[model samples]
Target chain A: MPETILQTRALSVERGRQSIGLPDLTLHAGGTLALCGPSGSGKTSLLLALAGLVRPRAGEVIIDGQPLWRLPEAGRARLRGRAIGFVFADYRLIDSLSVMDNLQIARASAHLARDLDRATNLLERLGVAPLASIRADRLSQGQMQRVALARALMNRPALLLADEPTAALDEAAGDRLIDLLLDLGRDEGIATVIATHERRLLPRLDDTLFLALPAEAVA
Target chain B: MIRLRFVLQGLLRRWGSTCLTIGVGALSIAGLCLIFWAQSAIPEAVKTRISETDMVVGPKSSGLDLALCCALQMTPAQGLLELERVQARLAMDDVRPFVRMQVPVAMGDSYRGHRIVWTTPDIAPFYGARLTDGRTWRQPLEIVAGSEAARSLKLKPGVRLTSSHGLAADGDAHDAAYTVTGILAPTGGVLDHLLLADLASIARVHDHGGEHDHTETAPHSRVNAVLVRFTSEIAQASLPVLISDSETLSAASPRLELAKLMALARPLIDGATIVSAIFGALAVMILGLSLMQGLNRRARDFMLLRFLGMSRRDLALLSIGESLLITHLALLGGCILAVAGQSVLAGMLASHGLTVSGAVPFREALTLYSAAVVLSVLSALGPTLRMSIARDDEELRA
Candidate 1:
């Protein structure tokens, strides 16, 4: 039992009056976990809670042994930047910047000394290095997805959280991306948690957690 | 470095919106520049003529109006001073009188319906005028034309022409033919538009011919206004009283009149500047709104940067940098446009017979630039504060 990099116990989230709860999820270092659920089943909510992007209505989220919410706002933000990488479902690339600049910003934001060579290498590894100088808006969805991945890995974060990372890719491209993500996680010795509705991706995960619909809904 | 990259990327991505903002800013800047340039140029132009004149004497009325007419060549009110009385004042020790008559001469006849001004050679020298063509009026019935008048009438020296009553071609005609003597050089003064001849020429045409009557019994000659110069030793204070108390004359000082005129015009100038400033403030407000909206969209991006390890202070700095860059570029653009516009306007006014001189005022330019920068920064305050204080948790979701 290696220590968990992120642990959320009985976490609950409320939007308006509706509430979503995820119970006792523990993610250890150097592993890949998949969060599977149907539409509106709160998979995204659970992911946000673990990433420290959302405040759980109940219970606590401990990242690398420190209660994330207990820290000062600035302290928590610094921890997130240093330890976490995110691949948003929308691939939120800064469209005004070139692909290379996007990665550069991510690296700098992480408080890491800018390493142009490392950024170039990551872009090359993700097969987006050639598009590095092009504006993000000019790139296609697959290219943008790759650039997003490169940005996430720029700081070699302790944990990587991805939401529907393969949604915009074709089957062949999706598999390739998943393979790259897994390989990158293994190489960096970082934990990765992906939330998605795509069941086809289930076989590729190291472990799977199904977020069941609430009991009242099942009835 | 990463923050810089991100901001740059953001600007590029929304280039259409960015360009629109820049254009709006540029236009306001340009407009401010033009207004300041014109306002400053007018006062300088007025001052040039005022500095040249020792004093202006005219009928009792709005001193400003008289100043505007006599010194600036604006149309004067219909009041005539007796020419002989003015001439007598000039005869006093150390008094040099430069008398001018407003020959309401434009209305009678036009050579081909173009307007002509009937005046004397003193009209040219009184305003320090030069000839662009042949010569100033050397003989009676010989005319020295203004550039516009010359261009409009298509007249050259050596040509002979007739006059119409008043300034219109349809006005009554005077049968006497006058020869074009010399065209006056452009002085950017009121003399540009007047038709210059000897006082005898005007008297001859108007049939007011009479020998010099030195007798105190004679009625004073009919003339418009007179410009007087003191010969170093004669006190100006005594002259006005002496002229006003005399049998039939009133005198107005050019310096005093212009001061009064400027005082009356002060409120109007202040109102215009205030309105301009209000519009500028509104523009800044609009810029602030746009920036605030953009901050909302970039909230998640800011969080992403935070999550990547950027400090809140760094993010705040990035916002300020972006604004400063835009403001600086806009200010530069505005200054260039204003200077160019001023030169163009000055040239046009000179061509139209009003001499405008001196560069645009540096203080005015500085005022506009400072106003723009301050307002722009103030407008940006809302977004900058919002971003700086934003919670990381709130930003992560979007």
Candidate 2:
């Protein structure tokens, strides 16, 4: 029933002398798309292209009715800062900074007013509020992933791109993380794209995109 | 949107490297300041001390020896010039026309490690010295101590001290004690370290029994040197020739001699300056390399900042700001250390009867300080520009 927030048409990304193309896809706000693939299938590449971090060799990535690739890198960066939040597979938080500082990085880059209280509330919602003052490197992997999710939500972006968010967590923690991501999308009216190899998380999303290892990847 | 605190945090995390780099920068700056002090302040001090005297006439010897003994109270002359000959020449119509004033000085004694100088009362006003305590020396066996000599020897009005035979404390002391009749105000020159007395006092101390003697062996009557100020510019051309050719004494231009001496020292000064500059550049290079290497290791951190939406220009500025902060700290430390070092050097040279001004000349200091900053920033340029132009995720992928 919600309005469409993300759509891609004939998107093809060049990867080392070969091309990986995505099928035309559209998703509404409050919807979740689970992207599953084998190794070397270009799942991270596709997520990166959708997040305006990488350019596509052909076709268009449309987010909120704006052509993401048509904008210059700076323009695309601004759009990414304003509308897209990403959680990398490695949870690339600055090790020298504390958990609160990691979240403040988002607000700083997007020129948003620093609201530590709001970041703390999001951390509390993500169940890692107790680790707020601890440096990021001192946190456990599961704790780091949760902080990454909290940081991703810091800007309150409309579209969240999570690449292997629960790859290092146990089954129960992974399920809890998936439930939290889906519930946040439904409650905040966000469009979420999660690229993961875990098949268990596929059925819980609103829709799924399956990718196979490319012929060149095998060669 | 790059907060400077992020750069600060990164530096603090690598505090060891940061402090070592800053220390190197500070040492280089301190060395440069010393060179600047030498190249500018010392010569200026010499000029300030000798600017008034036009010519120095002494026993025929090296011009340097004449200038040093006559003006700076440095080095002893070979023998005294005949006072009668100088007097007879001054009485001549030809020489009297060019000579505005002539103050003859006699030396050969010391009091508490300070040179005891003998000259007439006319020499006081010639050097712009005034009595800050008591009256000037008007009687034999009475002395006026300069401000520094009075303080260092702990002499005041009415205090008495025995004079040594030669210009050193190791010499045998004379039987008679010279009364400190006055104390001269600080002139910020070699005079501040001299004990001034009338020529009669030195005559009494050396003669032990003679009175008003103008004999050649009498140290007081035989002038060691004469400080002459010309009334007209023509005196410079006319007088030295008239004195050196007609008389058996040397008439050396004090200013010319000082300039020649400084010129002779130019190579040494320039060499030291070059070495200090090289150290400064090396320090800057090490600082730049350390910061750049640190940045390499923290490439992912910058990538994350870019991912969070900070622009590359802001990143570059942040890096530059960090370097500027270190350089500013080095500048401050260098200035303070330079002052301390200059004071110590001035103190050591005071014992040699040389004046070194405490203040570093502003122009040279500014040049060195500015160069330090420029070199530091230039060294950081390559790394900052590299960081700025790098594509997002390039560092992360590497």
Task: Tell me, by lDDT, which candidate is best.
Answer: 2
Q: Write the per-residue lDDT of candidate 2 for residues B1-398, one digit (tens) a residue.
A: 22666777788888888888888788778888887787777788787777768888878877778888778777765568778788777768988877788888888778768888788899888878899999998788899999988998898999989988677679777788899999999988667888988888765787666532333225566878888888887786668767777547887777788888988999998898788777787789878987797688778887777767666665676677778887888788887887888888887866677777756678877788788778777877877888867755346456
Could you tell me which 10 consecutive residues in candidate 1 chain A have the lowest summed lDDT?
A210-219
Which window of 10 residues has the lowest lDDT sum in candidate 1 chain B? B211-220
| Model 1: per-residue Cα lDDT at residue B337 | 68
Estimate how well candidate 1 is docked, as a DockQ score. Answer: 0.40
Candidate 2 has a TM-score of 0.87
lDDT of 1 at A210: 44
The superposed Cα distance between candidate 1 and the true structure at residue B183, in angstroms, equals 7.2
Residue-wise lDDT of candidate 1 within A68-99, one digit each (tens)? Answer: 87877567667777788889777888777788
Task: Score residue B45 of candidate 1 by CA lDDT.
Answer: 68
Interface RMSD of each: 2.8, 2.1
Compose the digit string of candidate 1's lDDT tens values, residues B1-398: 55655666556656666555666666667667777666777766667655555555555555455566555554433466666665666666544443222222221224443334444455565567777788776667887787756876787999998776543446566668899978877666455555666555645666635533211111225455566555442444555655566455555566666666668877887776666556556556656766676677777776666656666676766666666656666666656765677788877775433566665478976777777777777777887788766655546554
Candidate 1 fraction of reference contacts recovered: 0.71
Please list the residue runs of candidate 2 whose C-alpha ends up more than 4 Å from where it truly belongs after superposition: A1-10, A23-29, A59-67, A70-72, A206-219, B1-5, B12-20, B148-156, B161-175, B185-189, B207-219, B245-248, B329-333, B358-360, B388-394
